[model samples]
Target chain A: MLEALLRLPPGPVDLTALDPAATPGLDGGGKTEGKAALAALGDPLADLQERLFAEGRADVGHGRAVLLVLQGMDTSGKGGVLRHTVGLVDPQGVRITSFKAPTDEEREHDFLWRVRRALPEQGYLGVFDRSHYEDVLIARVRALAPVEEIEQRYDEINAFEAEVLGAGTTIVKCMLHISADAQRERLQARLDKPEKHWKFNPGDIDERARWSEYRQAYEIALERTNTEVAPWHVIPSDRKWYRNLAVGTILHDTLARMAPQWPLADFDVEEQKRRLREEVPVR
Target chain B: MLEALLRLPPGPVDLTALDPAATPGLDGGGKTEGKAALAALGDPLADLQERLFAEGRADVGHGRAVLLVLQGMDTSGKGGVLRHTVGLVDPQGVRITSFKAPTDEEREHDFLWRVRRALPEQGYLGVFDRSHYEDVLIARVRALAPVEEIEQRYDEINAFEAEVLGAGTTIVKCMLHISADAQRERLQARLDKPEKHWKFNPGDIDERARWSEYRQAYEIALERTNTEVAPWHVIPSDRKWYRNLAVGTILHDTLARMAPQWPLADFDVEEQKRRLREEVPVR
Candidate 1:
């Protein structure tokens, strides 16, 4: 139910319509309950991931894998979601890449080239801290690309997602939606604490100054690129616990639907058992 | 005390002398106590890792990092140590690499080429499931390389590690020591459980048959390459709890010694605070 509520609604993507403070469809009444529910999802979530990993390693049924793309404005709890939600699964089964501003070499290729290289191999739950969507969001807001090129990235991204799906990877694209007011409090908190100092950037204030532009950019990017093949989910992230729970639940349900079976032994099981019982002793 | 005891001692590396089930110098007396002690390490371990990560991010003090190398026979629980011990830290700050047999492309280059590429950046903890020592271990045991070449690799590996230390990574090399008997039980357990079938390899039988040779190779490799800069720790791994606890303690203490400071804010905090409170508000 929460997963359905989180999906980017079927029309123009409107940020103002969603309340960052609202925890619609959440099972719990408050943060304490929400966190407990999140903890509850861990064991089952870890089991599902193990099954999926087993399926990938077996190379069974198209070698299915899941990629969860996390996109959010500054201080919208993307790192928190990664630390809490993705952390539940075995780190061996998960690959996390936090994309920063591109280097000169990365800029030499097509926008998707570096992304293609970073695609999670078979049997992994891949997470992107910020993803290719930045091309449309930051690229548009900052006019880093010409209008036509920026317009073209949406179709390119959809086609890319289709290709990723065709390769048997499920993409869960999430935009952590936070209000400007929430952003202010988070930034203020960072400035107030000495330990949080490393996270603060003066440029963040510059971006905050152009908040409305970034909001419009995100809306247009989501609206144009959101597709049935790989739908975008706008997660209200002002509540860190709710954000993590929503993402974890969606991922858990996705793996369950996959229903990866225990791969039958490629080796002769009885023979291996016999060897273990009788033969495998030399040293 | 355990850290000092576990260190590959000053003379020849002697696998036969170590007890696979021994919880040598473990502060906790038994499994129940060990498990609780390891669990208690969660907060302190997590804090130390965050500091190391912060230092790396700050690019201060030589941009230091820690690399934990895990080496073991099959069924020796390399994956277990990763999941239970390394998993204690934030996944974002930990990079885990599980290396298998090198491909033809990898073989074309020097052995440490792929390894050098996999080193963790400053501000991250790196774990290698199996590492360059495999060049000497299996390569010598199976005669995959000429005897002279395998002998040369020991020197090359030592020099490679010294260079890595010079470049700011503190390497923690651990050999998960499990007896042949322990290996057989683990293999048998895999054969017994259908869910674990994916892990069993018939070829493991082949390797087990050559167990004595592999053990000798490990001794030689460890003897030649053990150095003051990056010494090997032999983790008696028959008991998974002790193995995890030992590895966790070594890594935890290593981080504590690093004592990475929370970096000073690069920008003016007061200026950013004033701006957050007053100026950066439009949308």
Candidate 2:
């Protein structure tokens, strides 16, 4: 199904073992050379992305909003994907919102409170760094809330996404898939660097310890929340280059489907000239 | 002075024009070759931007938040300039907030209330589409409140922006300058397209009729609010490509000046490999 949906060449990472029911195994162990695919993307990916962005910008005339949801574990290349993907789109029509740990007030309301307010306006794109999936993932992993409450969030998130989709928002959820080894290396890198010291939290190691648990949480979240309107794509992120290419490709495909229109339907040189004439006052 | 500024080969669109006492004609005549620069950026630009983004991504470190305020008339190309300028930065580190007419609750509070909540986190870029300046501009133009109250708002805005900058946020304010004829064409384009129908507001025409008042209000705003820390750039909007290039160049230059550092003090493959072997558990 994934191969048919994507026209780009398949990435080198083996996904045959990407079973939601079972845990992901060793990095680069299944049957593919991840390094080769990353190198293959080359320079064309960027050009393709810009073209897609320009098309999306013009298409805002269609009065539809595109909401891109980026969810991944720590150091899973969410930042990389966002930086590259949004680089192509016009900044005027795009808004990127990052949802961090809930503030005191945020904890007081439903998990979706902060997210709902960040929805994109008609004819714009809204990118969420870490979405409401936290209500299921983090809350469940940390045992921050009761089990029933955590499970119920999946249904609530689905309904919430459905409502937004019905209201002219196209939601594209991407789950960045990274290897345990890669994440540990990244986390260690964060600790090693003085500037990155602020990013390294001891709790992250604790979360790393609960790797299996988090995986289960992610599986449940994707399986329950992934639907017709807001489908989740599991992008292999061990290769930052591949992660960027996959995201750019997905966004390009989706925007192509939406097909935003240009501001002017019919170019009228006479009208433009007339307007210009009126504008230049005889000073 | 305008010629000298423009001759700098599309550098940061330094907002010196905002000084009411410094230069008078600058509000309408500032040159914007930003879009041309963007197109000219070519492969080198892409390569640099990708490297910059990668550099930005590797550290996972945050930097001072730069808030760009764009305030102008309906057809002033505020959207166009924003789209082009932000296109040059790392989206993961940027946030754009478009402030429109306040909601009922917003009206009850001081004009800067909603804006305060949307302040970007440190090391991120926050671009205000139409910001607190509206309290002074729209309130004065639309006669939403009294003259004394409106006059007080100018200082309030200046002070507010200064505080944000003082709190480690870099504020860049831009006002798009469009000829009367250009606006008419843009409005007509909106009206001409079925998809764009919603964006075309008859009220904008009425506001355009009071062009003199808006111009005067904007003049006073530029005079009183442009400060050392949070300056405003008046960008020429006659040519969309030029505007994009000009704004994009300014932003690119601004980020370059910031020179966001990677948290890593140095690269150590041996240490990384050692840490992985010792700390990382095998599945």
Candidate 3:
């Protein structure tokens, strides 16, 4: 079921054909059961993260890392996924980057420049909230750049991700798919609550007006950039519980496949211990 | 009881007066109960962190931050405190910097330059694994600088911390006090385990030989630098569980005093909700 969600086909994609509320990964379970499944993943993810952290800090230099990229429409539960899924692990071993509009210094460089700098170091679980796909998505829809230049970003992103993959970072890109109706309800709820109004942006309504264009932009970007090295998983995210569960499950599977180990020491352990007992004072 | 650990007295201090095995903050509880008490703090810490994060991300610029500095001898359980205490909060709201031996670039700047760069942004909980005090402690003990120069750093650090406090950041400094006998046992244990040998440095033993000098150095540094703006808390750290509990309790108390609030939004909530209901499409 997880594999079915991965964008592996070598053709143009249709966002309209896929159901926005599907939960194929759920085992005929409701929100409670999905949450339970997510909770079950906590120990394993933490254990894997510790091993990865230890490996990265070990004397040897062959350590690896994992990067989880989350891309979605506004109010589509990216924050929910982060709070519920990645929040289970220890913060010491995790690196999270929330990408906002590029700064003046960032704008001076290529799009990938900031993205590359934010990549997780070895032995960490890196999470990106709205990644470089923004270059081709919003940049395409808003005509922030030339159409041909936006077209060039797809291949550029693909090559850059391939380089990262070759350098021992496992990348899992998730596109949280939510219906326009679901987004409307979410936006309404945010506006209804005084404490949540800080999250409600008036400009988000303008972005919603160009929804079809953004969807088309996402479809083309996913079709052009999805590769065996880094596949895009289009997750039905209308149900926040199922979205958290699915993302957690994907990350668990990815770390399991990596199987980072606790590194062995490079010194003569027995001899060192014997010397310490013989020479050092213990009270 | 926690107040007893805070170095609020305005005079010279003696390290010998503090017992490394004391558990002044614990309620006469054993390790099991102390662990449970530490565990109880998880929810409140997480909640405070979320409020801080939300307030920081809001348009208002009045959000404040907390910076916890962990300074102690090697094998004094700084790592344990970090893993057990600060680990309870969301990584998204925390920024940790582990200061190591100075590099060429770091040495080129004033000692506080690297530390200033790593200070947490508003609403974050910043942690320094080993901080700028090393310039006074190790540099004094090892005679890396002239005696007059090393003596001057205590005043410099006090002024630097005063500036940081003025910027709306609460600072807590903790010295993980441990016995030399405990250090020997920890070093031996590290040497006995193959996986732990990487943490064992032969140079540590050389430093251990000059333990009294190091103690004297710490005493002068703490006495001179402890100020109302940033008082040092000398935590008993021979027992790892007690150390974790004491530090966690101190942080919990500090943040509770801060009382970071969930910010009220600046927009008109009812109007925005009505606009969403009328103008937005909902399936």
Candidate 4:
């Protein structure tokens, strides 16, 4: 239910249409109920993750993987989703990459270089805190790249994703949708708390002032890069619990559908058992 | 209390001397009690880890980090400790590396070369599933390397750790000590279960048969390489719950001692607050 509701549809994505405060697919409206629902999903999420990892370890049926790409304006709770949602799985089975502004070395190559290098191996869940979409979103909003270069990235991203899909990597891109009001409150909270002061940046005000421009950039990026295979999920962000629940539900649904089967042993099981018990009996 | 009980002393070590089923430092007996104690430590563990991470992110003081290295024979519950103990922290701040049999490329370089690359950055908790100590353990037992070369590794390892210590990385090494009978049952359980069959390698039986040699190798490795800076702790691993609790307590204690402070804001707080409220007043 959350999967179908949160997964962005084709043709156009307008920021003005969707309410960031709306809880679309969640069963209960209250915070306590929403959190309990998420906690309940933990065991099953862990089970599927272990199966996926077991498949990789034993070279099971499909050499497939999942990539979760998170794109959000500052303080949209990307870290919260990562901590509360993805934390349900065994960390060994998950590969997380946080993309900062490119270093000189990263900038020398095409934007996708670092991203491609960080792709998860088969049977691992790969997460991108911020991904190559930055090339379009921030690059367009700030004019950080040439106009033509920025223009070229949409199709380039699609093509790159197509190649990844062909290689059996399922891409789940989520645009953490937050209201300007939500951002203001969160930024203020950061300012208010001394412990959270490290998270606050003075430049955030400069960006916060240009909220509409960044929102427009996201709409463009969403419209251009959204694909049927790798649909974008617009998670409402005013409520942290709901956002986490929605993303967790979507991921849970995706993995359940994938339903990785445990691989059959390559060696003779009966013979190994005999050898384990008798031939190499306990000393 | 747990740290003192588990920390190996400055002398020759004997595996037969420590009872694998013994639950020292834990107040209550049984699996339920041990698991409860570990669960209680989760919040404090999470808190300390975040502070450590904050220090790294903001370039806070000292720039120190922690590395937990696990060295164990087959079925000593290394995976359990990782899932139950290290899993207590945020996965984002934890860097875990499982060192398998070195590749041909890894062989071309010195063993420590790969170890050096996998070292945790400042303020992160790095866990090695199997580590450089593998070069000493299996390499010595299986005669995979030369006698003279293995003899030199102890001194070389000490020098290498001294350098790592100088750079502010605290090394905590644990040898998950399980009895031969415990390993037999663990191996038998894997053989008995189909879902776990993927984890069973026939070669494990061959290794199991040579249990005494491996124990002797571990003892030598512990004696020769153990230093004041990075002593080896042998956790009795027959009871998986007790093992997890002990390792968790040791890690919680280590991080608490480090007491990483939340980084102070590097910018002007009052001015940012003003700019945040006045210049960009929620549009």
**TM-score of every candidate relative to the true structure:** 0.98, 0.73, 0.92, 0.96
Sorted by TM-score, highest first, which candidate order results? 1, 4, 3, 2
Return the lDDT, model 1, position B187: 88
TM-score of 2: 0.73
Kindly list the per-residue Cα lDDT of model 4 for residues B138-164, writing each as its tens digit: 998899899999889989899999899
For every prediction, compared with the true complex, DockQ reads: 0.76, 0.24, 0.47, 0.64
On TM-score, the leading prediction is: 1
Candidate 4 Cα outliers beyond 4 Å, as residue runs: A280-283, B281-283
- Tell me the deviation in Å of residue A194 in model 3: 3.2
| Predicted candidate 3 versus true structure: per-residue lDDT over A217-252, tens digit per residue | 989988998887898888888899888888888888
> What TM-score between 0 and 1 does chain B of candidate 2 receive?
0.79
Docking class of 4: medium
Candidate 4 Cα deviation (angstroms), residue A120: 1.0
Model 2 chain B worst lDDT run, 10 consecutive residues? B16-25
Alpha carbon lDDT at B119, candidate 4: 89
- Candidate 4 per-residue C-alpha lDDT over A1-283 given as tens digits, one digit per residue, 9 for 90 to 100: 8889888888788988989988997655689989998999999998988888899888774778989999999999999988999998888888888888899999999999999999988888999999999999889999999999999999999999999989988888988999988888898898889889878888888888888889989999999898977889999988999999888888888888889878788999899878876764444
* Predicted complex 4: DockQ: 0.64
lDDT of 3 at B120: 85
Clashing pairs in 1: B56-B123
Q: Write the per-residue lDDT of candidate 2 for residues B85-174, one digit (tens) a residue.
A: 565556666677778778999888987789999897666667888888888887887899998998888788878877887776767666
